[model samples]
Target: MHELKISIITVCYNAESTIERCIQSVINQYYSNIEYIIIDGGSSDATTGIIDRYKGQIQRVVSEPDKGMYDAMNKGIAMATGQVVGMLNADDVFTDNSVAGTIAAAFAENGNDILYADLNYLKPNGNVLRKWRSGQYRTGMFNKGWMPPHPTFYCKRSLYDRFGIYSLDFGTAADYELMLRFIHVKKASVFYLARVVVNMNTGGVSNNSYLGRIKVLFLDLKAMYKHDVQLPPIALLYKRLSKIRQFF
Candidate 1:
């Protein structure tokens, strides 16, 4: 697995409080040969300072203005130079040091183009609120509203080289679009490791408000439509209700 280089990118903007833990999680991984890249969206806070503190550990650090969260992610994707590339938001982190090592071994064992796993959603105070069970990847599941949490998702660089970068058009659902385009539309081989890969803090951009939730459903419908998947509004409704079941 060491032969395959994995590049993990973290996109940050005013994430000073959590960036340190995020960086340390990657740097302290048991698996060697990870290309860690950090893209900062011109943070006015101490984000840059925290990044500089661990500059020696990261392969590359870019602090510049970007369009939005998705745009910053695209910039990092362009800079990635590893066999497989993945993103972990500044506020989120892997479940453990060996998560990356586990992912690498899955790819080496299966030779799949994409890999992902389950994730735990935690509160800002570090309380576990829910477990997002990303059931194994299966073609046509997008119509059923089955998606791997974008943070826990990892894909080969070639997949992006062929399908293009995350589309800024979808806004919060851009990661959803890219995953669908690559895995469902392009039919890329995907492997789902049945384990928790990341621990993401619950209050992210998509769940920040009522309107945000509506926007996610709208864009998700558009993404499904573009690929000829044809998901009805009820599917989104069912998916939402099914997700709520995880909180219990």
Candidate 2:
């Protein structure tokens, strides 16, 4: 069997303090056939210098001005040349060195178009803040406000070519919209690995402020309606309520 090539993209802006951990996690992956790409939003910080330090290890680095995180991710996706593509944010790290290897094995055995696992949110002191357990996916789960963690999501490159990339208009909720479009609308085959794949540090844009959460809520509703989801109000409610369990 031919070895599957996996592309992991990390998108960032002004992430000088935390970028190295993210890079190191990918570099330390046990899987050898991995392509690592970093997309910087023209950060006016030590981020560029930090990225330069790992130039030899990274396959490609694009440092330029982008509209936002989602735009940077789109740029990274376009540059990817691997069969499977996954995104890891600047503040996220793989749980262990075997993440890529485990993902590759699942893809090889299941032949699923999309693969996702669970994740952990860590505090600044490296303590677990929340445990996001994305259970197995089933048909109609999207309507029930179920979504896999974005950092743990790995999809075949062809799925992006078919269903399209993230939408900028959704703001912080673009990832939710893309998942709903692909899993719910396009009916892509998905497999869930019941293990933690990534550990994300606290303080994401979506949950950073009350205003940000409101924007995310409205954008999420828009995404569901745009994708023809039934009873979006109920789904939105369930989505908001679902996060409460992650805290405990």
Candidate 3:
């Protein structure tokens, strides 16, 4: 069987502590056809040095000052030469090498343009904090306050070429806005795999503080309004409670 090449990008800034594990996860993938790119937003720490250690394995490594995370990601998207592109944070990793292969198989089976899977949240000490089960993507799911866990999602390069880059205006919800713009506004076709593909460390910037969650909710509301999409207030209540269930 011909290998399906997937371009995986990781954006980082002062992530020396977790960058190594993330790079290794992609470099050591059993799937040989991968274009791995890492973009460092002028890290003051040892993050660039860590990325250099694996220079031989990476397809492209860009280290420079950028406007923000999304800016760095746009560079990665431009440099990628693979058919499929997946973004994995510096603190997240694929569950195993077969994960990419499995995603490609689904694409081949149905020719869907976008693919997504479930994810788990881990603590700093590598303990499981919660399991984030991102259910299948169906029409009206967004109206029900449903979204694909961004970290575990992958898209064909063509999708980005058509829809464009993430809006730098949205801080944490840039991924959310991009999803809505593509899936809701443009009506892109998608597929969901009911499997955990990635493990992301908790305490990320978006949910590290009470204020952050409040800000996220505000941005989420703004994102929906821009697309003329409305989710019942009760749906947001249910989503919050469902997230709480993951911890137990």
| Per-candidate clashes, comma-separated | 0, 0, 0
lDDT of 3 by residue, 1-248 (tens): 67678999999999989999999999888878899999999999999999999999998999989988788888999999998998999999999988878888888887888888899999878888899888767787777777788997788899998998888878887898898888877888888899999999988878889999999887877887787776546546655677876777
Q: How far off is residue 243 in model 3, in Å?
A: 1.2
Show the lowest summed lDDT stretch of 10 residues, model 1: 230-239
lDDT of each: 0.88, 0.94, 0.86
After superposition, the stretches of candidate 3 with alpha carbons farther than 4 Å from their true spots are: 231-235
Clashes of 2: 0
Clashing pairs for model 3 are none
For each candidate, what TM-score against the reference? Answer: 0.97, 0.98, 0.95
Judge candidate 1 against the unseen true structure and give its global Cα lDDT, from 0 to 1.
Answer: 0.88
lDDT of 3 at 109: 87
Q: Give the per-residue lDDT digits (tens) of candidate 2, residues 1-248.
A: 77999999999999999999999999999899999999999999999999999999999999999999999999999999999999999999999999999999999999999999999999999999899999989899988998999999999999999999999989999999999998999999999999999999988989899999898899999999999887999999998899899999
Best by TM-score: 2
Roughly what TM-score does model 1 have, to 2 decimal places? 0.97
Best by lDDT: 2
Determine the backbone clash count of candidate 1: 0
